[model samples]
Target: MGSKRRSLAAKPNKEPKLSRTDAPAGLSPLDWQRGLRRQFGREQAFGLENLGSEPFFSEFRVSNPVSKSSYRVAIRGRGPGGNFCSCPDYATSELGTCKHIEFTIGRLEKKRGAKTAFARGYQPAFSELYLRNDGKRRLHFRAGTDCPAELREAAAGLFDLEQDGLLPEERFGELERFMAVASKSGHEFRAYDDALDFVAGRRDADRRAALLGQVFPSGAADPKLLAVLKAPLYPYQAEGALFAVKAGRALIGDDMGLGKTIQAIAATEILARHFGVSKVLVVCPTSLKYQWQSEIMRFTGRHDENAVRVINGGRAQRQKDYALTDFCKITNYEKLKPDLDLIAAWAPDLVIVDEAQRVKNWNTIAARALKRVDSPYAIVLTGTPLENKLEELISIVQFVDQHRLGPTWKLLHEHQVKDEAGRVTGYTGLEKIGQTLAPVMVRRRKSEVLRQLPSRTDQNLLVPMTEMQSLHHQENADAVAKIVQRWRKTRFLSDKDQRRLTCALQNMRMSCNSTYLLDQESDHGVKADELAALFEDLFADSEAKAVVFSQWTRTHDIIIRRLDKLGLGYVSFHGGIPSDKRPALVERFRDDPGCRVFLSTDAGSTGLNLQHASTLVNMDLPWNPAILEQRIARIHRMG
Candidate 1:
């Protein structure tokens, strides 16, 4: 058997003659012979069975001639980590190629009558070095044998030099070092035109770093910059604004209620004051469009009506509004689709996407339209940029800097952990991703900057009502309008008219809470859904607790259903619960680690020392300012 094996191996020593026609296209006869030599006559000796033919014939089975062993080869595409073979050498070599893979490639090349660049072996000109993306959508570095020794050595640890002289993309830190050496070495390094965004992003980062130093010499915005603002910023908020201004296009991902809107406003002021930014576009939820305009005016102290234009009305009207060229244009996400062209024409100098998570799904029309605006600078404000999936964060970041995370496929491949069924199970390399995003993303947890935080932060959330709720609300609103119209005509309201107005107002408020609160039948309303979503986030931290107050006990019942659905522990403190049991309810919410929610009415709103709760929710607004303050004080009071 040993002699037989030796004889078989010796038989491949004699060279076989072949014409240029036999060689794959773009491959010289000599190079093709060299490639065959490297294969050690495996193509001739081995038996290759094409497994599937569709879409590139990407699967093959190779049988070893001597050992009679078979290995499966999956042609994953052309790159360092693309192809795979169930063979020991292929698994351990890091060469991305093996004898079986070579045999299969040779067979496929002959069948197709042409060789891919990967199959012919990637070899750049002796003095040329460049970066290009492969079929797998991964960036690679191709260098020639005569490339400068310094450049090659510089890339040694950073790039994995493959058998085909292609180096796959790696961490940016090492790539930066390699490029620095190349720059100093006076060697011309080229990048594929389309792949040059990565290079441009790096250059932008360098410029931003320099600008950051110049603008924030003391690690915070200059007092002169702050002085222009109507309101003073906390130390951390000043840093956040400085970071956003320096980044040019950035995501401010501070926790909810950390004043992301104010930070973005401050950044816009800095840009206008120092960066020649006069026109700004603010895209946000429909309900918050006016709020954005109000904040911009209040913070910039530019109360002139013409200073900010809130785009509204039909398409033609919006088009006319877009032509105004005000200092700022505010629009909602829903309007972006129809007015995308108008926005591009307006060409604002800066874009602030408030509540950026609305565009977390890249395939959504709002996201697609917003992405096409193409402003010089962008700031994405999201309290929870990554509420669930990493892809959501990627989508949001892409809005500010599309190429910051590289191609989506490559990013997912590098980080996503998939199950056997090909579903993503989890993610890896999150820390590495964070490092890559450090330049364009500024995320400060409330805990991280607690010292700079105010004793209490207030936020007003606007939730859209459900279809049924809206229907009921509109009916009551129409009635109230009619009553006011009747009163205007007669200059007085009868007893029946006054009772009708009161009942209509009360019904409208109840319907806004939930349809079930009004009719006690349908459990449909957005407030309950919104509250559930809020609890989903608030309770993510085991120690986190919240106090929920509503003027009506029926609203608590609706909210309790949602809390029950979430399997969250809660204590209901309404008038019906009796005063004697109120203390135990508050005590349970304050002491029990599992009890993370305190549902209450006005009865439990005052004189409660429930400082353990960090979040407060109002199911429905109270008529009196004092009552609202009391409910807030339940959780916002001094610890």
Candidate 2:
């Protein structure tokens, strides 16, 4: 039998074996015969063993006679690209066949007749579902002759089989039904799952493309909308406004000092003019309520001065404010719970949430309250939307579009990388998540739009006073008011009275920073907390460094303590530090990678070349604008 097998293999190369039609395209009959001869030689030379059981009957183990090596070949289906072999030649050669596959095929052909072998290798064409990105993006279905009879009957009226089988974009419900039938009937539709994924991906891409067209109609913003705005928007800001309007609900997570406030205002205006989005509701930090009101009044040319109302005071007063039909109403997040029903009743057309990271924890009362407001349009503004974890971002995004990221459990399962102990170690599939968020979330770093930014951009962040700080501030402020009133009435001041007035004013300023700065005891103050929060964000980026200036050395002392708690490195430059030692401190701040902060009193504000710092923070405002400019110039000067 062995000699007969060897002679059979050698005879194929000498004779004209099969016709030219039997060979694959582009091969001569003699060449095809020679190739068949090599395969026959391999089949006879190697040892073939069945790896699969009688019922499973697909896998075979082919052993190399010379090298003593072996490979497993699996018969998946019929013909080329159907079977798989654990061989380098099969993987690298695009022909989709190897010696192992040929040997397996020869065994099957011998067991079954030549007619049955040929019939098994032939695969008929089947129905295919694919995406076509022509003038209109739509799903195209091709019904082949081999399409299942049950699938065709199920899709009889739903799809036009006589036509090109073009599925309308609006008939996705019918498409889902058809897919269900096809899936249940076990029909072999090519690219079925991939077609579904393509539909979802194209939905997001369509949204983005539509927004782009609206934002850049004729390659620019609508002139009519621009005419209604009091202030001219930077090109990117205008795009951001239109993006928010186009998304209907979005998260504007531009970096700090990037004018998220202006973008939100612009979006509100665009919605008002183009989409009949009136009754704007601005929910922000308590300290920024007035700022929002001011911005609305400043930028909204169509809205009068009386059109914007800041909701504050007690419940009755807030309810009255909510009752008003003002074009814009601004309120704080803290009041959401008490006035939740009132807001629901008011039903503003658009809701703007500033510093939206406050709602990063979706389970929190503030976040839930904001989510319950149920506005048609939402613009969430946060400089640091994702401060710590992936969940924080998901939570914030939930407020804008609940279904944008799909279910929380599924998202975490797919992206969250866990350890042996089930603790989350890191994340994966971030690029996919980003693609999912591209339609609803708009985040721009300062570096991305650097050309549109001015040489210097100034932003004033109003930090609310803590409970105790507010009490102390109110007391000193009242005392100073009394002193001023008495001086105005009499037009004269005694030395003791002037001294008392100065003390009161100074005490009020100190209380704004921290009670420790005033009494050297209490550490409760919002400014220091806000500074620490800023540093937390700044230091998140390795390249970020800041020059923090506070006029009072005592303020620096409190901040330094906080920095120590955060385990951040810093160089302090104040009058207390000897002049001779200042340069070395500067050198350390400049050269040391660990030092991310340059904490300074006003003494080092001038004549310092600390251009390495990308950010500058003022703990408290200076009395003179020149002094503020000097503090900014320390980092903002020419490189």
lDDT for 135 in candidate 2 is 22
Each model's lDDT comes to: 0.74, 0.75
Candidate 1's C-alpha runs over 4 A off are 1-216, 358-361, 408-425, 462-533, 557-569, 579-584, 591-594, 604-607
Q: What is the lDDT of candidate 2?
A: 0.75
lDDT of 1: 0.74
lDDT by residue (tens digit), candidate 1, 157-252 = 666667343545446546666666767776666553433554665567677678667866766847765565798888888888888888889999
* TM-score per model over all chains: 0.65, 0.65
- In angstroms, the error of model 1 at 637 is 3.6
**Number of clashes recorded per candidate:** 0, 0
* Candidate 2: clashing pairs of residues: none
> Candidate 2: misplaced stretches above 4 Å?
1-216, 219-228, 301-306, 466-471, 474-495
Query: What is the TM-score of candidate 2?
Result: 0.65
Deviation from truth (RMSD, Å), model 2: 16.8
